[model samples]
Target chain A: MTKYQRIYQELLDKIKTKEYKTGDYLPSENELMKTYGSSRDTIRKALQLLLQNGYIQKVVGKGSVVLDSERIAFPVSGISSFKELKESMDGTIETIVEEFTVVPADDKLKDELHMDDGNVYIIERVRSINGEKIILDKDYLNGNIIQGLTKQHAQDSIYEYIENELNLNISFSRKEITVIPATKHDKEVLDMLDYDLLVCVKSYSYLEDATLFEYTISKHRPDKFRFVDFARRSQ
Target chain B: MTKYQRIYQELLDKIKTKEYKTGDYLPSENELMKTYGSSRDTIRKALQLLLQNGYIQKVVGKGSVVLDSERIAFPVSGISSFKELKESMDGTIETIVEEFTVVPADDKLKDELHMDDGNVYIIERVRSINGEKIILDKDYLNGNIIQGLTKQHAQDSIYEYIENELNLNISFSRKEITVIPATKHDKEVLDMLDYDLLVCVKSYSYLEDATLFEYTISKHRPDKFRFVDFARRSQ
Candidate 1:
């Protein structure tokens, strides 16, 4: 391996092995430079490799924070928030805030977020493309980190508010993509047409410190959704 | 933008605009080298970017050929054939050949394959892990290109035969990943316990010369399927 690849692999190996566990910050750039006896650019290149490969995330004030390694193993493609994903496509998109409420963390939310007890923000939004409600997103967020999430944030980009306004660096996410028979909730919110099945992308999103900040389930109409990929023959 | 990045984008824009249409080979490396007034290595770097980003595919005797740009827009992840995909996961996998036959391409097949009239080979295979069948793959191939396909090839790896033995380069593929209600055919082939929905990945694979060579639909039990993606917050 080249120098940067070696550095990237070593850090990744340590992260995967849990030698440096999740939410743990890695050594500073100076420390990494000293450890690898490499230049700043070389160290940055290695760290960038880790970042793009989803092994770590760069926080504004903090150093590189280790992300969930298990998620790294299963990535199908690059991950982007809804806004970024849709902005690239040609569409007149609108978000409808169906519901926004803050409630005390239930047992399930407490367990999922790994928190003792605190209020959680629940935001439900329906995304319409070309005047059709094709996507429904239900987000459960830790109220502590994402304080005072307004209906505007729910209607717009929640990730934008968390990252820009809240000054928190959103890190990696563990996503589970599946197709399921639509529930009553899906039927009530989405333009279900005649399709019985829908695609669901459930994401457990973490912050720079690897705190589980949000749990989002985005449901899509089957015909309106497609996950495309490119492949070259692997040697 | 960096020089290589600029070159990559220019080429991509051209391809997307159909300035260079599909099935059209890109300019020779020497021609690009002269047009850009760069070294062979620098020219190559730009070409490599095109190849990786799914803009073009390299053939053995031919140069880089443009891939279907529309499919490039919808890519959810990297495309890997079944054998490559399953081999990456932990499992004692087995493939059972259910059926293999060659028949004249019907009108639907003719339209799908973009060929006037020719024989097409159909193969159905069941993929099992440990003991339970979890995946059913149906493949249709242009018999003129994929000549002399055998039961052993279907039982093993068809891509392997097409690449290694047949000396035909498997190039880029346009993929559609969706979840659909299981058909009666699926019920007969797969050991579907109770799930009514399944994840279907439809792939239209091409050869290096940009020839439509194969079309495959692989169905997986939803619980057994997950498409993961890694996203660094896009700026």
Candidate 2:
């Protein structure tokens, strides 16, 4: 470990352990330099890593202010949905309900959902973060259980409606993630003309009673796709 | 849900419940068609999904053979290491130790590992699956703790050596996943001419005592990359 790295680890440990709580400004550069006996360059490098990792924000004149602990974390993701994660990010997020309709399950759609013959609700949404269109979400809901849905429901949180209003438990999900080329639809909608890759996370969600209820494919511009995980060794 | 999807779900449920055990051949297409009153195409479609999803494999002389339950699963990955997952996959996997040397920790290397000044072991390896070079794994070990590591250890499994030989309790890791354009090294080493995208999983691993000892960057060709996750709702 070099001087900057040692300082980074120590400061990060302090931040995570709440020795430096959220909203508290970190010590000035001079203070950190004096404490570590590291040069100004070394201190700045440590602070830069913290900023890049979203641990702290360098205010123009107020030094580095610790961000919300829950809003940011050691890893950006655990088990949160796009809406949930975006809410924590506190960015200017907007969900555009591009298309919301009910259709008799086609063979392909039925196959994807593992269904026989029933109506399904389709929701096509584009997610813009910080004024940039980065994610396109396509969802298929079992219309039998989800008897009613509207654009308003699509714009807001559909999961919230399913769990709260419909009183269903969102138990678990199986997600298959892959990176693939951008499709025509993605090219047209996503603001990633220069970048050619997209990270697709296709999920099959189940209810508490073991009912497979939803299938969603979320396509994100590669640069905007950030997946972080914390894995505890399984016994 | 259509009739075929319902059948798919039922058969999948049976396979998962072990009603259709590993090595137990599934009911014939004729039998399934008769039982479900579905057409041959529909039954074939359902079986195709089963095959695609790795539930069963078709044999020319024999019917679809039930696959190894653990070798194949509902989702491919959980908390397993690359070797662990590959072994379960039953693939002919080869790990070539390209470079294994001890380097004085440079500032960048030290910064990545959060260290001040110590010797660090660099291990560069290429992973081939079924004869195709699909992954490149670069590992950095904290030489201060590892003391010594040989190329033979890299050829086998570093984690295994750490646990069985060194008696280190492997704890947890923080992983960051992203998709990016292939680098020059990636293009030169990986046998992925047609594929231009790469999925990168960079990890920082710590010991049971919270000693950060390992840093790894695993680069994979996009088509060969499959990240499956199972998320249980947290309270």
Q: Across residues A1-235, which tens digit of lDDT does each residue of candidate 1 receive? A: 6898899889878987899887788999999999999998789878867764546666656787775555223323445678877766787988899989999999999987778988999888999999999999899999877887888877778888887898988755555677777899889988888877778888777665445688889888876776754444422
Estimate candidate 1's alpha-carbon lDDT, on a 0 to 1 scale: 0.77
Each predicted model: what fraction of the native A–B Cα contacts (within 8 Å) does it retain?
Answer: 0.53, 0.66
Model 1, B3-26: lDDT tens per residue? Answer: 877788888889988999977999
User: Each model's TM-score?
Assistant: 0.55, 0.69
Tell me, by lDDT, which candidate is best: 2
Q: lDDT for every model?
A: 0.77, 0.78
Which tens-of-lDDT digit does each residue in A63-116 have in candidate 2?
Answer: 877754453253335345666777657679988888898999999988877688
**The 10-residue segment with the lowest total lDDT in model 2 chain A:** A69-78
Runs off by more than 4 Å, candidate 1: A1-121, A127-134, A140-148, A159-174, A180-198, A204-215, A221-225, A232-235, B1-77, B89-92, B116-118, B231-235
